[model samples]
Target: MELPKGLAGVVVDQTKVSSTKNAVLTYAGYPIKELKDAPFEEVVFLLWHTRLPSADELSEFRKRLVSEMVLPEKTVQLITRITYEPQHPMSILRTTVSLLGTTNDVKRDDPPRILAKLLTAIAAIIRIRDGQPIKHAQKGWGVVENFIYLFSGQRPTPERVAMFNTVMVLHADHEFNASTFTARVVASTQADYYSCLTAAVCALKGPLHGGANERVFKMLETIRDTGQDPVQYVKDQMASGHKIMGFGHRIYKNGDPRAVILREVARKIAHETDNDSYFVLQEQIKDYMFKATHLHPNVDYYTALIYHCFDLDKQTFTMMFAACRTAGWLAHIVEQQAEGCLIRPSSEYVGETNRHYPSR
Candidate 1:
């Protein structure tokens, strides 16, 4: 395919980004194989900074991340208002982000302290809105640690905490996806960064974006209630011309590397949690998918089962994904700022061009 205008392949943005090779590469350019066995916390430091941190560096970073988890009082009130009632997670996230423009330092994006607060703001809003009592970072822990603690309401177990960290690291950045593109477009206009982020979040709310995972849960529920076997469910849905929620991808000709990584996590979590239902259902779907359409699982596919294994509510799956993805969003934003170009795109106008109004 011919590269479109705007350096369609020029790569002006140097943000922490990756490609799908069925091979993993983090924003920091670290190999995925090396990270696969490393602690998730370690990988996060790698992404935020170019090199791995020393033990002391890790300790200090943890302290900062933990402290950052505390949301502002006004933000708390905003989240409390929406999450208090039954609401869509993506709507709550995007709207709160738009409202966040009131508190951002868009013009002063260069200040380190100001930028830290912005990162904290996004993470805190998601946690606070989820009915999770937010926790500020401890004297020593950094942004990620504070998030894990606030999210789970207690100090996370070493292993589970690592899982959380790895997830954030893995999701830290992807190259110019829909939401990232939205954020970049808004930022190009010198508008509020939060406005860009809010636009991105709204884009993510679409079923084709982050919302598909929630739909997967609904699919499972429907199948269970209808007492249909997995094979039968796939057959009926396909016959009716329905696409499975968690299979196939535009980029992954072989498979999503993230899906493979997450699938292993799901297996470990499933075995540990002793939830037979998730894996049992997963197997059924996998079989049915292969038999019916040759479609295999994607990241969101296993994520639904994994969250259920974590005993998380179906409503908040997207928010959890958002939490991890916030890192990626920031990475892209900073990269766009470095490029310093307005992200204006031209449209082919087909309306009447030279027509003049009748002289009265």
Candidate 2:
């Protein structure tokens, strides 16, 4: 049998968390367009349990997630010590997740608590690296609101919260993406949640995956700061045989559904934050890329602008991706562990397998 490179179109396992069927993203059978406006906690609950929660259940779930957002004091100390300038945020995050497993009461931990702690820990990494004090999650506010406050050190307006909540909901899951699949493979062995999450973080650090957004922003900054025409920049880069970071995806031939939703959020937030120039440049490049290459923008394209509007450093962008994705990772980990099967697969021998060594 012939197999495609990188297991393209291969079905290794099954999952119900999310799907990009026909290039339309859905979480638990609900279309992404419908869920895009739902509360982030509601969407997370859906991904985990495969159904929407009732009003009272959502309220209680929000409270529980917010309540668990506080990191243990020891974890905070370790984070402060390791979050110096040299280390990448994703590196800090990988070690921190591993530390959470070892330093906390991890034996009784569930998805909600693990998700809450990860959000808090990611925020703490941002703050500590910036020399700002870590902010606590507010009890009354929802997860997205408190998460923004925790990292930015300011409570955002309700409108801002709504925009960010949509961002989180869109990013919460996608069926068996690289990082999610990595988590599942680890979880197939019944490994601990943090171990699974740590492996997922490592996979997301590659430039082709979660790191693409940062490179997208870097391209925008290059065009704006160098005063190069956006189209010319694209031409020159393509001439040099460099792949534009955010133009296409393996699954979405026409366009990414999430990018279609996030474009409006990027526009609104960019204008509100007085970062409209960057968004304008993005539009120019986006139009030229499509006309030049017939490629549509993927989710990473606009999300780079959104993160820039939020005043995040480009280096920490993938860590933010990891934060939203941890929900799906935890869900898959739970599912794979419950299934209780190892994911070992047979490989075809392509080397000189018939040769025998006479002496060594």
Candidate 3:
């Protein structure tokens, strides 16, 4: 039998959490565009339950999530040490997620608490690395508001919060993406949530997956700082055999729907933050890329600019991706556990199959 390399276009299993069917993303049967403007908590609830939450249920769910955002004292202490290790933020995050499983009562934690802690832990990693004191989640603020405040150490305007809410919702899940599939593989073994999340983080650390956004920003910075023409820089890089970081995607041949939404957000925030030059450069590069290669930007394209507008360091960009994606990871973990099947698959051995034993 012939098998596709890397399991490309293979349907290994079924999931109810999300889908990329027809190149449109949906979470639990709701199209992403319809849910884009919904509260992040409502989307999270819907992903977990496969149904929208009632108003009262959403309120409680939001409150519960915010309340659980605090880390245990020991975890905070450990994170401080981990953050200052001069490692990549994603590396620090990989260790930190594993640390969470150790420092907390992993066996007793559920999805809501785990998701909340993941958010808080990610925010804390940013602050600690910057030598800023960690901020506590405010009691009455919603999850997005509190998450922004925790990392940024200031209250965000409603418009900014709304933009980020869309970011979180858009990233919440992509059915059987690399990291989510890694998470599900671990979950199929009935590992705890943190273990599944840790494996997912490792998968996402790869450049072909969640790490693309940081590289995208790095490319922007190189072009901006060096006074190189953006178009010329891309041309030179392509000539040198370097892959452009943020263009094209496997699933969305025409364009990424999330990129379309985030392009607007990136434009608004770029103008607001006086980063319009980068935005303009992006548009030029985007247009030129499409004309030259018919390749369109994916979700990471505008998100790099959006994070820069938020005053985040480029290295921390993928960690932000991990934070948004933790909700989806938890949702998938739960779903895989419910199905209770081992995810082991057989591989075809073609390497000197019958000759190896003779010499030994």
Candidate 4:
């Protein structure tokens, strides 16, 4: 029997967290188009519980998440020391997640607290690398608002908050992507939350996964700095047999729904931040790619510009991905652990299987 490589299209397990069936992304069966404008915390609650939170439940959930968005002083001191090592923020984040498990009361930490800590930790990594003191979460602010404040050290306008909230909501989950599956594989071993998250971060650090956003921004910078014609840039890149960084997806042959919504967010934020030129360059490339290859932009395409408009360095982009995705990772970890089954799979030996070992 011929098996699909990378387990593509194989249903290894069932999930209620999110889905991409028919190329439409949904959280607990609610389409992302409707949920993207919903509060980020509400979307998180939906991912975790498979239902949207009631009014009081959402309010309390928001408060709890904000309140827990603080790190232990010892953790902060340790993070400050190592975050300036000239390492990628994603590398720092990978270590910080494992450190979090050891430094805190890991056993008692629930998903709310774990998610809050990761968001705060990712924000702190960016701030410390930039030589800025970390900011505390403000009372009465929502999760996305306080997250922006923590990293940027400024209160975002309500409009900015709404836009970023959509970014977070859109990235909160995808059913059984590589990193989520890595988390679930680890969780099937009954590992702690941080371990599963750390494994997920490692998987996300690869160029093909979360790291694609940074490369997308790098391509934009190359084109803008050289003043190259945008369409020519695509032609030249493909002529050299290089894959375009942000075009195409494994599942969505038509287009990524998240990219459709994020295109507007990126447009608005880019205009606000005087980054309209980059956005223009993106449109040229997007149009050319579609006409040339029938490949549309995925979520990573516009999100690069969106993060740039927020004043984030390209290196920390995947860390931002991790922050939003921790919600989904935690949800999957819980679900996988509840099944209480170890994820062991059989494989046909593809190498020379009959070779006998020589006596040493």
Residue 282 Cα positional deviation in candidate 1, in Å, after optimal superposition: 1.3
Q: Pairing residues by index, what is the TM-score of model 3?
A: 0.98
lDDT per residue (tens digit) for residues 195-231 in model 1: 6677777877778778778888878878777787877
Q: How far is candidate 4 from the true structure (C-alpha RMSD, Å)?
A: 1.0
Ranked candidates, highest lDDT first? 4, 3, 2, 1
Per-model TM values vs. the true structure:
0.82, 0.98, 0.98, 0.98
Regions of candidate 2 where Cα sits further than 4 Å from its true position: none
Q: Write the per-residue lDDT of candidate 3 for residues 1-360, one digit (tens) a residue.
A: 989878878999998999999999999999999999899999999999999999999999999999999999999999998777569999999999999999988777999999999999999999999899999999989999999999999999999999999999999999999999999999999998989999999999988899999999999888999999999999998899987888988889999999999999999999999999999989989998998889999999999999999999999999999999998999999999999999999888877755545665
What shift in Å separates residue 71 of candidate 4 from its native position after superposition? 0.3
Q: Name model 3 segments beyond 4 Å from true.
A: 356-360
lDDT assessment of candidate 1: 0.66
Separate clash counts for every candidate: 14, 0, 0, 0
Task: List the candidate 1 regions with Cα displacement exceeding 4 Å.
Answer: 1-16, 21-24, 37-45, 54-56, 104-137, 140-145, 349-360
Give the least accurate 10-residue stretch of model 2, judged by summed lDDT.
Answer: 348-357
lDDT of 3 at 119: 95
| Candidate 3 clash pair list | none
The positional error of residue 35 in candidate 2, measured at the CA in angstroms, is 0.6
- Residue ranges of candidate 4 with Cα displaced over 4 Å: none
